[model samples]
Target: MAGGAAPPSTARGGYRLSALNDDLLQEIITCLPVKEAARTVVLAKRWRYLWPSAPLFLNDADLPQPARDVVVPRVLAEHRGRFRSINLAYFRLASLDRELPGWPRLLADKRTQRLQLTNRNYLPPNQIGTLPHIPADILRCGSLQNLVLGFLKFPVDLSHGVEIFLPNLRELTLAMVIISGEDLEHLITACTALKTLKLTSLTPKRVHLRSRSLRCALVGLSRVEDFAVVDAPLLERLVLYLPGTGARVKIGYAANLLVLGHLDTRVHQLQIRDMVIKSGLKPNTMASTSTLIPSVKILAVTVNFGVLSELNTLASFLRCFPNIVTLHIESVLHDPSVSASAIEPSGEHHAKFWQEVGPVECLRSHVLEKMAIHEFRGDQDEFEFLKFVAMNAQGLQSLHVVLQEGDTSSSDDKKVNEAREKLQDLRFQTGISGVLLVLPKEGILSTLQKATDLTYNDPFRF
Candidate 1:
């Protein structure tokens, strides 16, 4: 009797169909609004008991203090034993100046599979210790699969080494919580089945993590993925950010596992910084030259020119990612001539010394398919640099050059016309297609019109 509906009519009389199966009923319940799902009991005589089977979705924003008090008791009275998930967000209980006593008991229910509690507002002093009450109960629920707890001011203590005993837990997210290093280590060791773990605003400054089943980890700390702290065996995707000046951080991959197998299988995506590659190295000595992450097909690198003295180091590091088809550089200066004036003059021949360092050579035989230079400024050195690139980059299909306007001299205008003439000639010589020169927003039209006229050859053609 699926959906409590009657069977197809026979010629003789109406026949009652069997009740709906669990899977079909669950699907229908999921489609219904929380209020509608709860009210479905009044739809028909047979549906009176079916509303309890509907999955629970509690939005704290919609629940006023009176509404919560009214709904919580009614829900517990009707479907207390049937709830599978409870999502609580920004729930502030005003009725009870003290913590709600029944909240922990409800989470302890064996049927509860997922629990999410997030309080973004500042809590009163008395409510600071209320977080542990929920975790204390949830640890007993063997069916718990996902747990997320975020606190604004409540600091957590993991010094005693709290272990989530739920063996089926797969996802865990903790924010603004404090955990001791030893307790953090113990937690990772205990949660062998966890697949995703995210930690933010953690205390004690650092935590050591070693897990066999962890697949994804997002850490926001001053130092994350320190080789001495993390030793995850099956971790495939990691997003880490380190904040704070003058603090050194280092991360290492196992020598035997240079190519990340999980990434190759489409199960992992790695985001690593260029600074991480240069950390923990002597001035001239190179870091480990090889990585085991062969499965990585996409890489986004942010090269800090301030840290890298030579541009060749950036190129050499890119070469390591062999499978990289698309490379995105956040802020890269292809033409080194832009920073010429920034160098301080030292002696009588300082100008000559600076001139020699101006455009070394253009990227000739690079593996990239496209290159985008943001804030591009063109001069004689930059134009010559473009010509050098035109000679190389055989696979190059697209080129984007963005220029910033500042002070322009008459000599600069003459050099630009000459460069445009050379580019127009090269465009005809080489079959290379799709060349776009983007100028500054202020004087773009005039610049393009002038460049086009100088390079125009239609009038000379018969």
Candidate 2:
């Protein structure tokens, strides 16, 4: 049979062969260290061609002035047209004027796809003006895709607005940079293909962000989103940090709602599917309140509910999110009595007053489907108050009661144990899932394991 078999085909004609070869080449190139790739040029005539095709990655250590002066010129001379990508990072050139001319020229090559320039220190103020003109030769290049600039300080006269057009750019990250808001707006408008934009620790005097192509945005607390400026029809994720005053204040409005209103008509098609707002509180400044309710599916807020006045205000704000299916309330005033003195009961009798005015069922029915109360201290009064609301509200499917350990008074201990027993009884009688009592740390896990059956299966460890 072996002798009779027809001669094997000599041609390598198959899709599998091509795919395997491509994958093997990618794996081999990825496995090789940069040093090994650079050394390929000295291996032999056959290896010389491979080094030019290798990805060009230049970091501070690889491009020390002495090494750079020798290797850079050689790389540009030989691999100028063959380079697949160029990453120039943490480079400290001896002279801005001397380096600026060649740097942009090197980046302008149609072969360049990734260009990153990060300076360790601020560039000389006088040299800042020369940066924006970014050699017209480089700007005209159509191959660039990702551009990241760090520690860039532009001159005050720089009017290149936020709309700096880069037709092919997809991702842009500007860090520790100073630009005027107008220039920022110009840059946003110019980059029609920009998809992801991150601005951090930037001091833009008057910032305006009006982008038609931006899909994801990350802005600092100091800057507010001017939705009126954004024209992107497919924008999805937005993160903003609103500046906070030290004073404790109630959240009256949803920040997402306010930002969404400012967005242009084209932005209506742009869905803000996710939003996050973070703020710090001052000792006594009035708190920022928001009421803007956008069509968001997921929302998360972290705030200190130390002021009793803010609780109802927050509840009112939450009612606006009609589509919200999940709600989380953290570090809420578990023991409203801690500041009970501050809350003036409306009626003469305190007990009767709470029974009459407390909108417990209103809160349970209006916004919350399932509620999780974190850092909960088992005060019987608070538990009884929650139980009363749970009994009335039909929507509450699950309830998590976390018990935080602190300096427990004798009365407090008795009240906690009684609440645990009462909650257990309620779970058995009403068919409501028993309250989940959790310990805050791992050290107490074993101690709590022996203490109660209600200990959470995986206790939250802080």
Candidate 3:
């Protein structure tokens, strides 16, 4: 061996990754799961000390159940760097009370940024009210940006004059959390910089929101009987993804609202400004602007066009958003098991209902640029609505018809071809040259990640 030659590298066959510099190695370790990241220490002598130098990311849900209790505390105590994110979603509230009294302090000390501390224990609807309250200290993380708390109770008492604030927090998600209206208001008002808020499966009877900085809000799978945007000047997107039936949703004073949708025509009672929308309500006349909401540029509605009353409800619903640039229609299939007397008989007059429903200002005024129909079963009623849009939406540049999955009668390709042909025929008659796209339903499900993303223009598109 020459005197100046470098010492034989430990880089062995198939272990070429070790040849990379320490910074790259640390980054690779940070991206791995906590378990796999920890195991990297045993890979080589050099790798043994690299884990603690990188930022920590711990998710208890990814660890084995038996090892979680031991591993979480041990890693939290041993880690010597800041925490990138922590998700303790697999632990019960009772376990946290007994085993981790200093957990919140540990997080703050480590400069933790994103935390998801969830109680995974199942609670029935009646028991939810009695669930354990969130630890006050957990809300004190000043460096926190994104927080997700689940299956806990929010403290209702603000009597002590103690304030709760997260100055840098941006995104917050409360999933299956029990919260009184007063505390809910306080919590939201405290996060002054907050941008995105999601309320999922909450039992709160009423949710009245008021935020100046909030942009995207989603209320889904909740039993909230009344939900309203009380005063949000900068709010843009209000999504009701799968709200329970009989919910009344009202939009008030949100002048910048750009995207809204999935308003179930059969179940939701919609009110904009001063007007309470109903099935029989007609489009705005030349003299009245009270019922119109012109700030909304994107609108989504769920309807069973098979039902005559719901079709009319949809017509009334669209009349409110007179300046909608994009329209998303979720076609709900009607049940055939109902008595024949309940079903509207299909006829020439029924097909002409869209034409007779007067004028939808958004379509007739050429503000609607893009239109998409989801869960399209190729039913006649669905085509009627598309035809109406095609003929009236003079500025519509793109039309997408997404077919429902599991249609056994024909292949997906065949369904797409048939839909394209029908759309072509409609275009031929209307002299519309807009691009038409027909897509299968596979891999197009909307995800929570997309729902919370403020940058994603249309969260409900997929």
**Alpha carbon deviation, residue 272, candidate 2 (Å):** 13
lDDT, candidate 1, 213-238, per-residue tens: 87656555543333222566666544
What is the per-residue lDDT of model 2 for residues 95-150, given as tens digits with 9 covering 90 to 100?
43353446555555535677666665456755654343233344444567887776
Superposed model 2: Cα runs more than 4 Å off: 1-27, 30-33, 61-77, 81-85, 93-100, 122-141, 154-163, 222-232, 242-294, 328-462
**Model 2, position 171: C-alpha lDDT score:** 75
Candidate 3 residue runs with Cα over 4 Å from true position:
1-26, 39-50, 124-126, 158-162, 282-287, 334-348, 411-421, 427-430, 433-438, 442-445
TM-score order of candidates, best first? 3, 1, 2
Query: What are the clash counts of all predictions, listed in order?
Result: 11, 39, 0
Which model is ahead, 2 or 3, in terms of lDDT?
Answer: 3
Best by lDDT: 3
TM-score of 2: 0.58
Model 2, residue 449: what's the lDDT? 33
Which candidate gets the maximum TM-score versus the true structure? Answer: 3
Range of the 10 consecutive residues with the lowest summed lDDT in candidate 2: 260-269
Off by over 4 Å in 1: 1-26, 73-78, 93-102, 123-134, 152-161, 222-229, 241-249, 253-296, 304-325, 332-462
Per-model TM-score, in order, reads 0.59, 0.58, 0.86
Q: Candidate 3, residue 359: CA error in Å? A: 1.7
- For model 3 the local lDDT of residue 171 reads 91
lDDT against true structure, model 3: 0.78
